[model samples]
Target: MGSPPWAADPAPASRLPATNLLTIEYPGYIRDTSDSLDRALVSLSPVAGPRVDAASSAYALAHLTSLLERGGRVVECRLPSGSGVPDAMDLYKHPILGDVTPSDHVVVRVHRQVWKRMVNGQEERRKHYRIEVLGASSTCIRFRRMADYAFRPEMPAHASEHPTMKLHKILEEMDVAAMHAHRFMPEQEDYYDGQGAQRRSNLAMIPPPFFNRQELPFYYGYRQNPTSSLQTVTFASTSKRSRRTARKGDADLLDAGNDHAEVTRYLNRARWRNMAPVAVKFTEDGPVPTEPDAMLAQMALSERQLAYLERLKKHLSERPVWSRLSLLNQFSVADARALVQTKELFALVAYTFADGPWRDALVRFGYDPRQDMASRFFQRIHLRGKAPRAPTTRGAFKAEYGQASASGKAAPAVGDAQARPATHLFDGQHSTFSTSTFQLCDITAPVLLPLIHAEGPSDLRSAPDITTGWYSMSAWEAIRSSVSKSFHALLSEAGPHKTSEEAIESSEGSGAGDSSEEDE
Candidate 1:
C-alpha cells in the first residue's frame, strides 16, 4: 500500500552477444536500375571481393547481399532523385585520397535504413536510390572500395600564419641607419648637392620682400602707439631661454650679447613676414549728417585733417586734375607728412575717375568729364621710341596749326597753344615722360561723391545739366562726335613729318595743351 507497482525498481538491461560483421561499403549510391548492381559488382570485385566475370556478377551480388543481411540489419532508404548524396560522394575521388579513378557510376554505402507500414495493412520496403552519371562512355566509370578512408570526416583546415607578422618582426629589428638606406628614403646627397644649388639660384632670382626701403612719405608723421605700457619697457632679453639662464646666474650681469643676437634674428624674421602695407583706420565718431554745416559741427575731424584738406583743395584748384602717382610724388616732395591720411582728405574736395580717359586721376569735384573737351584730349598712347624735337620757331607752328585751320578744320585753343610749349620744355626732366607720358583726360560727366555732403555755396557736388538730357543716346552721340572732332583737329596740327606713333606720343606728352603745371 505504501509503494505502488508504478514505483517498482527498474530491471537490469540484457546485453546482446557481439558478432564479427563485415561491412561491404560501396563508394556511391546503389540504384535499383537494371544491370546497375551487376555492373558495380563486376567493377568492384577485383579490389573488394572474389574476382567475378560480367556474366556472373549479378549472382555474386545476390550472395554478398544475403551474407550481409544475415549478420546485420539490411536497410533500404528511398532518397529523392534531386538529393545531392551522389555529388558529396564524388569529393572522395580527390587526389588527397591517392590515385583516385574517375567513374561514371557513384556508389553509396548504406548506414541506416527506414521501413514504413501502410494504412492498407501492407509492409512497404523503400529500396529505390539514384546516382549521377556523366555519360554512357565506359572510360568515365570509376571503381573503388569504400574503406576506413571514406568514414573519416574532412580534416579541419589548419589556421594559417598572418602575412603581416613577418613584416612586424622585420620592423622591430630595423634601426635608423637601415631606414635611411631603404629605397623609400629620399636621396639626401643629391638633394643637398645638386638640387640645393639650383634651388638657391632660383631663390636669388626672386626679389626679397621689403628690399626697397624707400619709406612711404605719406606715413612720415603717423606713428603707431604701443598697445600696452609693458611693450614700451625694454628688458635685457625677451627670449624665454635667455631669461631662464639669466635667473640662474647673476641677474644684474645679464649677457647683453645674446639679447642683441636674439633681437636681430627677430627683426630679420619680422621684416620678411611684414609684407602687407600699413593701413590707416578712418573711424566714424558720430552719425554722419547730410548737411555740410551739420557735418562740420558734428564731425570729429582733427586740425591736421582740416589743414590737409585745405592743402589738397589748393593743389586741385591749381591743376583741376592729377594722377594718383603724380599727386603722391608732388606731396612727397613738398610736405612728406601732408598726405598721411590721403584718402580721407581727398574724399572731401575731389573725386577720382574710376575708368575712361581720366582713369586713376583725381578730378576736382565740380569738373564734368562729359562736357569738358580737355578730358577727351588725354588718351593712352603707346610710344615705342624717343619723342621728336618740338618746333622751336613760330613759323613751324603756323605752318602746322595755321594751315590746318585754314583747310576748314577747327583751330587749336589759346590754352592748347601755350600749354604745349611748357610740356615740351619739361618733357625731358619729368620721369613720367621718360618712360611713358601720362595725360589727364577732360572731365565729361559729373562725378558723384557719396562721402561729400556739403550743401552751402561751398558745396563740392557738381549738379548735372538736366536740360541737355545727357543720359539720352542722341545726346551721348553728339557729345562723342564733338570730342572726336576736337581730338582730330588737335592731331592734325602735328607736322606731316611726325608718324602716327610720334603724333600720339607728342599729344600725350603735351598734356592736351592745358596750362596746368605738370606734377613735379
Candidate 2:
C-alpha cells in the first residue's frame, strides 16, 4: 500500500531555491571487463538562460530541468580496473540526439543496461533495436563490428556486422516473416518484375480520433448528410455557424475546436519557420465499390478492375488535405513489410503523417510544422508509446508542448528534399522503431474512405490510451526521480536522502524503480 523506493517523497515544488549549475547523469558507461561498468556524468556551467535568483523557489532551474527532461536514463554503473573517463562530449549529448559515437564500450553499455532492464521483469512497449552480445565467441570483437556500422566505416559487409546494423537485419528478417504470414490477406502485390500487371493506387485522409493524431493534422472538417449517406460537405473555416451547420448535417463531424490549437501551432511553425515534410500528391485512381475488399475479391481480370475504377470517378474527386498516402509512396518494400508486423494501423499511418508528406502538406494547406516541434512530437510518441492528450489550457499547452532545449527559439527546421523519406534516423538506414506501419489495403479500392467512416462515439476517442500510460509509467517515474533528486538537490538545502527520523516514518513507502531503457 506504500509508495515504491523509486518513488520520491511528495516534496514541495518550491522546496529548492535557484542555481545555475546543471548536472546531467548519462546512461551507464561500459566497463573494460565483462563484470563491471562505469556511469557517466557531465556538469554544464553557466546554464542557458537569464541570470538566476536564489529566492526563485527552484523555478529558475526550468532551463536546465527541461534539458534533463529530454536527457536519457539515469543509471548506477561500477568501473572496471583502470577504465578511462567517458568522453565529456558523449556525456553532453543524449543518445537519442546523435551526440555519442558508436564505440564497442558505448554499444556494450547500451546493450547491457537494456538487457538488465528487460530481465528485471519490466515490460517494454516502445519500438527500438536490441543487440545481443551473450554467447558470442568474443563480445568485444562482435561489438566492434557493430561499431563499424555505427561509425559508418566503408568496410562493406563488415559494417553490417555492427550491432545497430545487425539489429536492423534481425528485425528485417522478422518483418519478412510477418509479411509472409499476412501474405494470404487480400491486397495489392508489389511486384518488382516487369510483368506489366495493371497498377492502381487510391488515397484517402483519415481525420483525428480514428487516425493517429500525432501523425495527421486536423486541418479540414467534414459534414455528412443525415438524410442520406451519399452526400458529404467540407468546411474550411473556424466559426460557430460552421460548427452548428456541421452538427446539423452530421453530429459526428470532427470538432475542429478540439484540435484547433495544435493544428494552428504547427501550421504557424510551418509558415514562419519553413520546417515541412515533402508534399503529398493529389492524384487519384477512380473510386471502386464502397466495399472495396468485397469488390477486389471478385475482380478477376484487369478489364473488370478498370471498369470498377472508372465508376469511382462519380464519387471520388481530389479533396486535398495533408495525408499519409504521400508518405507511403516513399516507403520501401522492406520498410512496408517490416511495419506490417506490428498490425497497428494507427501507428503506421501516424508516423507517415508526421514526417513523410504530411508535414509539408500541412504547410501548403495553411499550417506551420516546426521541425523542432515535429521532432518532439515523434520523440514523445516513441517514448510514451502514445501521443500526449492535447492540453485544454494555454498554460497546459506550453507546459505540455514546450521544447526541452527551451531555447526560447524554434529548433532549426531542415528541408528533407535530399533526405530519403523511406528511412529516418541512424545513418538513414534504421527507421525510428517508435511505431508500426504494417497494414494491407486493397490497392483496388478507396484507402482513406473506410478509415474515415468509423461508426458512433468510438470515432472521438482520440485521447491518450490507458494501456500506453501504464506501460510507460515506469519510464515517467525515472524521469520524475531525476528532477526530484538531481535538480531538486541543486536547488534545495535537503539532499536526495532522508534523516533517521524521516527514514523510519517513510520506511514503508519504498519499492524499486525500473530505470532501464526500453529496447526495440
TM-score of each: 0.23, 0.14
Cα lDDT of model 1 by residue, 1-520, tens digit: 4987867877755443233223333445667885566454543322221111222455545654563446432221111124422322222232111112223333333444565668678787776554332223212222231222221122112314222222232455766665455432222233233344532111101122222223223446764443312121124434456355333334544456543332221122122221211111112123222222223234456787777667777887787766544454444222423454345555556555434445455667666555554343332222232333345434533322222233344654323222122221112212212222344232221211111111333322232222221123343333333333223323346323223334335555655532222121
After superposing candidate 1 on the true structure, give the runs of residues whose Cα lies further than 4 Å from its correct spot: 1-299, 332-341, 374-435, 440-520
- Candidate 2 weakest lDDT stretch, 10 residues: 141-150
lDDT (Cα, 0-100) at 442 in candidate 1: 22
How does residue 171 of candidate 2 score in lDDT? Answer: 47
CA shift of 335, model 1, Å: 3.1
